[model samples]
Target: MVHVVLTGFMATGKTEVGRRLARILACPFMDIDSLVEVAAGRTVAEIFANEGEPCSIPRTAAAWPRPGPSCASRPDRKRFSGGWGTPRAGRSWRTRTAHQIGLRASRRCSPSAHLRMPLPPMRSTLPSSASTTSSSACAGSWRDGDGVQVVEAEARVTAEGAVQEVEVGLGPRSYSIVIGAGLLPGVGTRLASLGLHGRAAVVTSERIGALYREPIVESLRAAGFHPTAVEFPDGEEHKNLAWLAVLYDRLLEAGLERRSLVVAVGGGVVTDLAGFAAATLLRGLPMALVPTTLVGQVDAAIGGKTGMNHVLGKNLIGAFHQPRVVIADVDVLRTLPRREFIAGLSETIKYGIIRDAALFRHLEERLSEVLELRRDLLVGLVAACCRHKATVVGDDEREEGGGRMVLNFGHTMGHALEALTDYRRFLHGEAVAIGMVAAARVSRALGRCGSETVGRLERLLKRAGLPTEIPGGMTPTALALAMQTDKKSVDGRIRFVCVEEIGRTSFVELTAQEIVNHL
Candidate 1:
């Protein structure tokens, strides 16, 4: 329902004003900080002293909803304000659920001047059809020696049930990323809204499909689409042309047409393979992605790059096929193995360093809650990443312009490590973790960044339980050799992404010998 979120800098009397306005409106008052303190069994001061301010934000955000009608408040506006309530100078919060209704309060400038409290910003107002039975408002007020003034803002909430959408701008090939918890059951309805009907093929790995495919098939059937299940072996090793061929055979057997949709229902591997099949089968079919893993949700499935890995190098064979929609149901992450979950953080950490420095600090400060799968924090983190990726992809959908190459910050070395290990030794994320450390070293060697930058990155990776060092028995020469085949390499020179500082990166071309020398 509508939640009048009172947000501002600290000591702004948000709590005091919220309580008074709640009394005036005869509605309940909810203070996020007090809820956090009660849940933590300690005062806010003690939490900051012991656990630091970074930890407090996630805790407060996580605890905000448990005590009834809640309004999220952030003391550090610079970090939390942009993503949650208001759009910052450079960044836009485009999700349907995160829009802000700006409310302003002004006092008299003179005896003749009248106090004014304007209605919520026009952009934030809801549609006329929205019901007001469940609407709520919040106010933050203060008093001076002259007098006391109060400003209150109310929003009409829609009935979307917390589902938020981020659009990937790709002209005719664009799609929306739908994010929220408990979103799986509505997959059929969402697809129906997109005008997808007829026979649909739900492509997934046997392991993931067994757990999730039924609900998807049921949903599609209810939406007037005939659906079938196609399963393949799970894991990166199974992501090959052979499996892709099997998907084609299954689609043919099911009589799926060009208009038929392919629903990718697993993690990164499934998305890559299914998306490629959708791109190629019958010269292309519409596809939708339901990423089950953290890595898929944050990175792989959001981008339009789809491919199958070759023995020589990872993702050597692929195509650019954007999906019709990407449904990221966060609840699936609860069943993820601990190592897989931790591995996903590597990508999250990469996002922070490559573009958003504040996100990097948030990961460092709130590692525990993030690792614990706190719903609010994870949703925000995923949405932020999707936003960043959407912006980069909008500029260079095919990686033609150098704008999108910055995403390869740790990928050059990471892909080499993956190839060297035969896709068996380390997960993609773990290899990227080691690659990031190596890239940082290269940056330092080239005089781009100081040693402290490398140290901070390493420490953050370590805290995330990711490996930062190259595996034993692997030499710099061998790793450099593997880099020779990477897609980013131009001619014989490898195009490496080097970090200059947190949230800043540049691309550098180096010969194999030069890369080894840095190593």
Candidate 2:
């Protein structure tokens, strides 16, 4: 039997743990680090030097061997499910029960494996509602009127960020997404600067109506355009065809012309619905995107893909409509919950993996600062991500080929997950996070990517408080059915975005069995 022989510095948690482990197993326990330290009090280095013994040792590709038996001997390798499944062997005998039963019996119980991550939690990224406050640390708790309970969130700044220009390329239909947080203060001024005219409307959602309506109305009036406010239902569940009509009817009622501007201020779903509405209304008007969720700032707000999901699939009804201006003010994120913020990071990390490899390096290097909401670091991170996404969108506005498909690196299964749950269980970014992990794993399994790359991606996603695999709610068969229902599926073949390596992704065809194997 393999037994773990702990080998580390003396001050490590070995001795206390050894005692407990020994007690549990009814076996002898040795604190080798303590024994080594006791034999060489001052320094093992000095003893090695005096004895003239070589410190360098043999190395192997595999893990270091135990001095005697291996750690494998201590316990059986348990195939444990996340918070939702059967209990398995753990570090301690009572660990499994202690972890799963530690919290309330509700669905909101934080997964033990999830919390053990070195990074933040998924629940922390989104707030319960729009009125949440910033905290001393990056993680902030939030509650909404509905009591949805996102826990922690980050509302990406709703203002134009650091970029000098907002690229709005559509060939005669092209416009710019201006970068600056205060662009909303003088919404008309910014729109007029872009050479827009007629009437202007602040298109918001019901949840954010109380907090953001009046200022926008006043801003449009100040800018010499007829200003009206339009608010839709709150939350991602209802971001669909029904809500798009509300904005359409309001724009028509306000007498908005082709030259008018539709200022969208809220979350990704809001921008998606409003952006698509503006695209269809008056044959596409100049619309300014003010993304309020972290998912919006770096990803959704800049991508120019707008639409609503169908019961059959996610984002099945969408248009490639570029916003005239995208304002990503960082200050707004303070109101978001910790979970929403972490969820948003999943997309930001996607940009890093697909385009700017340096972004991942920065994320890994400054994880603590990113979680802490360090303004300077976040500003730079947001800007860099925007630039990456903007460049990709600029190249392929309609998602014809390679450039646009890169965005789908993990979305194929992700959309399926969203469809399976009816978009209630996880946030968009959370789904993408799980999708990306599946992509990485599939990439490795299919010989397109390396195992280490998959491991790194999993570790990073977990650190960002994202899920690395499909949660227990969806069974393998159900997951297969959902994937089959994906809109991107062609000729009954489900396509997966497989990674060849870091920063390289490709669309690959797979059978339902292959996809099920991935889960």
lDDT of 1: 0.75
Error at 506, model 1, angstroms: 1.1
Point out where model 2 deviates above 4 Å: 1-170, 180-183
Alpha carbon lDDT at 246, candidate 2: 71
Candidate 2 lDDT over residue span 1-519, tens digit each = 323322212122233333433332334554432333355563433433454222211111011223225554544311111111111222232231221111111222222222332321222212221112121111122233422232322233111122234464657756655443444576667767777766788888876667767877777787777878888777778788887777788889988887878889888888888888988987888788888778888888886788888887888888877676787766667667789999999988888777766778788788877888765456667767777777777788776765677878788778888888889988989999999888888777778888888887888888878887788767888888878877667788866778876776777788766877965
lDDT of each: 0.75, 0.64
The Cα error of candidate 1 at residue 354, in Å, is 0.7
After TM-score superposition, the amount by which residue 434's alpha carbon in candidate 1 deviates from its true location, in angstroms, is 0.7
Name the lDDT value of residue 415 in candidate 1: 90
lDDT per residue for candidate 1 within 106-197, as digits (tens), equals 33321112324332222221232122213233332443443344442332221113345678999888899988778899999999999989
| Residue range with the least summed lDDT across 10 consecutive positions in model 1 | 75-84
lDDT of 1 at 130: 25
